[model samples]
Target chain A: MENVIKIRGLTKNYGKNRGVIDVNLDVAKGDVFGFLGPNGAGKSTTIRSMLGFLRFDEGSISILGMDSVRDHEKILRDVGYMPSEAWFYDTMRVSEVIKYAADVRGLDCAQEAAKLCERLKVDTHKKIKELSLGNRKKVSIVCAMQHRPKLFIFDEPTSGLDPLMQRNFFNLIDEYVRDGATCVLSTHVLSEVNRYCRHAAIMRDGRLMMLEDTNIDEDAFLKYYMDEEEM
Target chain B: MRAVFVREIRLNMKQLIIWSLTVGILGLVCILMYDSMQGDMKSMADMFSQMGAFSDAFGMSTLSIATVEGFFATEVGTVHGLGGAMFAAILAIGIISKEEDGHTGEFLLSLPISRRRVVAAKGGCVLVCLAAFSCVCALFYALGFVMLGEDIPFSKLAVFMAMQLLMNIEISAICFFISGVSPKINIGAGLGVALICYVYDLVGRVVPDMKDYLFMGPYSYANASEIFSGADIAVAGVAVGLVITVVAYVSTFVCFDRRDLAS
Candidate 1:
């Protein structure tokens, strides 16, 4: 498989505060890569930097062989991103927000968006402010995936989703991954990575601690976190 | 960019409508009050003369407050000056900062668009709304003057309204520039700019030495006395306002393009 994402020596700092440091990562086409980390482990920082939201002080990032920062718009043309904390214009209706996203990206997403809304049990008529957290998350999911881009970057995407919806969401992503789309799922949920990902990278204190094939290092994976917990 | 512009206009439509109504209603009220105040012109002018400090602070120091244009300038124009400045500030600041404050910056910045385009789209929307607001106020103002049989020339009214819009843009651009650079925002910058202009205007009028430096303040540039006099509109003031507006917008584009947006 071709490498879809490549990062080397990535570092970002927040006024002496740790953001992310010397982070390195690669995700191949058709790979369901799990980026696992504890809370405050700089998982979001890394993801944000990769998406060119936060500028990195050191290193380079390329998506589909294009520079992430210099060619962000081109990269985003085929990238679907879902933030860990979903947010939207409060006054906009669910349908309007999704439509606006689609329009901005120049995608004809009405059919896909409507279908996703139906599957997620989202009410399109409700203003975003009127929706619950879970419903808002659904809206975010629909907005991110409606365009059916080639790559998906999801940051703790299942946080507010109910179990059944979570399963559905995972299954939707799985379907895409099986169809040759690449995905990077950032989550702290160990079982999720164990079940869905072939390979995973573990992060701690803004550093990558391990990258291993889930099946081959399943025992070691369990041991590493357990030992870290004891420390 | 079009999508962002459309979305901004839609989101801010209610606020724009309210502001429009406020400006229009104020214009009508000023015109209506002219009838009662016109008869006591000499006494009213004498009373304003005595309260020199008060008149200067609120921009009532210029022409006689008895003429239709003078009354409108002193009474209605004061409200428009302050109200428009505040409105512009709020609009500009809210354009960029609202996303970050509301926690939507990550989602917005993650889109398949450049940050520069996003800022440009916001700027365009603000300008559109500002233009619409100025036109609405001018329409109502002209209507009031005509209804009361006042003989104000259309060209003069047009120039006055244009100056008001230009002054509002200058304030909005300054606040917008502030928003582009700041990571976090509250109403402080917007309110601060408006309050500062008010104070600066007052000081410029009361102190003879500051008169030379009055152009630094937008209120002085949009002075009602200058507009109603044969001068029609202050060409130098408009030139200065344009310079400030252009510089502010350029700064905004440069800063927003490079600033690290906080989520």
Candidate 2:
């Protein structure tokens, strides 16, 4: 299978602070890849580098067979990215925010956006500031998924979601994946990985500690997480 | 680019309206009060003309304040010039940095648009807002002249407004460049820049030694008193201001393109 995302010798530094170091990763096409890490495991740094949001100190990123930096605009045309934090123009209504996203891509995503909004129980007429955290997350989800892009990159996507909404989010993901789309879900929630991911990579201290199949014995997985926490 | 441009204009519409009306109404009011203050201003102008540097700083030494044209140049000009500069600074200073400050950049940059295009679109919005601001203030001044049945100094007024627009563009460009380099919005710094430029021009006009270097400040070319008194427009100063504006805008694009944005 072709790789949807490929990273090699990826390294980034924030002056005196370490961002991510020698981080290499690959997610195959149509695979539900889980990037598991703790709060400060450099997961967001790596993801941002992949999306060309940050300039890595070394190595290169190729997404959808194009250079991340040189072809940044072209690559984003088919990628749906949900940031860890859902921040938007506070004065804009939820609906206007959604439309602005679609307009930037020059695509008509009204139907998909409407469906996602209804399923996620988002209030389209309310201003973004008026919405709760969960509602804002729902709006972000709708904005990301509405275009039906080929690759979906979600950074801690379920943070502010209620359990029921989380289930709905996964259900939406399942439907999209069924249509042959690939997903890279970066989250610390182990249960989410075990239940949804086919392959998982555990990262700690700005490096990848392990890459394994989710079907491994439950005991071994717990031990890996337990061992990291103890250290 | 069109989407970004449209959104920026919409986002700033409320600010544009507030600043334009504030400055425009103040200018109109000052103009309307000119007739009632004529007798007092005639005596004051005589005293002011002899007040040495203080009179020169405000152009009272060269332009009598007893007439409507002189009154508008000294009073309404100061109001609009200061107000317009502040508005331009505030508008452009946060246009780029606010994205990272507010965390909206993550969403905005994720779209299928390049960083250069985003900057260009934002620059376009600044130009539109400044143009609209200048037009509105001019209309208010015209209304005041009509209300008083005073003949408008069409030629001088045209030159003054044009120079003011260019001055605002230069101020906005500098603030825009600062916004590109900064990680957070700095309204205080933007206001500071405007005030400093105003003071430099004021001092340059009064001090003989600083007079030759007044072109370094944006307000030098946009001085309404000088324009109304039939003094030669500061062609060299206007040219230098345009050059600085271009350089600042180019620098902004270069800096913003390379910097690592905050998450």
Candidate 3:
């Protein structure tokens, strides 16, 4: 399998505190890679560094065979990102916000975005401030997926979503991946990772604890968290 | 860049309107009151002259209260000089910090555009809005002169307004640099810059030894009284202000590109 994302010795430090340290990761082309971690395990920090949203103190990240920092515009052009928290301009209607995102991506995405909104049961006419948390997440999903990017990077993409919507979201990801796209989903839910992702990487204390296939022994995977609790 | 610019302009339009109305309506009111105070110019001037520190702080020392231009230089100047700088500070500081404050940095910074482009687009929006606010003030000044039948020179007023706008840009750039590097410190940066400018202006006028440091404050660069008195533009002040504006913006762009954005 060809690697779509290659991160080596990626280190980010916040003053005396550690953000992510000596982290190395890779996601193969057309592979659904799962990044699993508990709260404060540096999952979001690592994901953000990959997108060039935050600069790292050491090491490198290449997305689609291009340096993420040097070629950020090029990489992001074909990448979809859904942050852990969904936020938008409060005064903007959902439709306007989607349109704005579409414009930024240089896409004629109205038709696609509208279709996503319809499928996700999102209200496009309401001001963003009026949307519920779930609705906001749905809006973010539409923004991220409207262009049908070649790679999807989702940080806790289903946190505020209902179970049904979560299933629907996974189905959407499945549809895209079947068309040769790749996905990296970060979540703490091991079952979700097992059910949807082919490979999983677990992180703890700003470090990678494990990287293996999801078909591994269930007891061994449970022991990793069990060991974490003991520590 | 175009998308960011358009979004910024749309988001800040309400604030622009509010600030412009505050200054514009206040200018009109002050001009209307000038007529009532015309007959008591001697008494008013004497009263202002007696309050040494107060008169100097408000630029009422050399300006007579009877003349429309003099009254504007002293009264409207204090308001716009301080108020305009404050508005600009809030605008620039909020440009970057608002993303973090609203927890939208992840969404915004993740866009395909570079951080440098983000600064350019957002900063351009702020500059435009500030310019528009200054234009509104100038419009009100022209309206006041017409309504009061005052024969103020348009050329001098234009020079003063230009100076005022430059001062605002300088102040905003300073705050932008602060917020760009460390968005969490936005409140401190905004208030700190404002307080420093106010103190420098006060000290320059009240203390004999601190007069040399007059350029430290934007107040001096935008001195409406001197401009109204037909004094030639202060090339030194303009040069210094422009330099500061340029340096601050360059720093903001570079820092934002390298800085770690908060999640």
Best by lDDT: 2
lDDT of each residue in A147-198, candidate 1, tens digit only: 9889999988888889999999988998888888999998877778878887
Off by over 4 Å in 1: A215-229, B46-62, B232-236
Highest-DockQ candidate: 2
Model 3 segments beyond 4 Å from truth? A209-211, A216-219, A227-231, B46-57
How much lDDT does candidate 3 score? 0.85
> Is candidate 1 or 2 superior in TM-score?
2
Tens-digit lDDT track of model 1 for B24-108: 8887888888987788987877688577666765545666787787787777777777778888888888788888888998888
Real contacts retained, model 1:
0.86
In terms of docking quality, how is candidate 3 classified? high
lDDT for position A131 in model 1: 86
lDDT of 2 by residue, A1-231 (tens): 899998999999999998999988888998899997667779999999988789899988999999999999999999999998899999999999999999999999999999999999999999999988788889999999999999999999999899999999999999999999999999877788889999889777789855656765656655545644574
Give the alpha carbon lDDT tens digit for every residue of B1-263 in model 3.
89999999999999999999998888778877888888988788888866876676666777776678888888787777877888888888888878877888888777788888889998999899999999998898788888888876698789888999998998999998887887574776786787688678877888767778787667776888888877777777778888999999998988888887877
Better of 2 and 3 by TM-score: 2
Interface RMSD of each: 0.9, 0.5, 0.9
- State the lDDT of candidate 2 residue by residue for B88-139, as single tens digits: 9999999999999999999999999999999999999999999999999999
Segments in model 2 whose C-alpha atoms lie over 4 Å from true places: A215-229
Ranking by lDDT: 2, 3, 1
Model 3 CA RMSD to the hidden true structure, in angstroms: 1.9
* Native A-B interface contacts kept, per candidate: 0.86, 0.82, 0.80
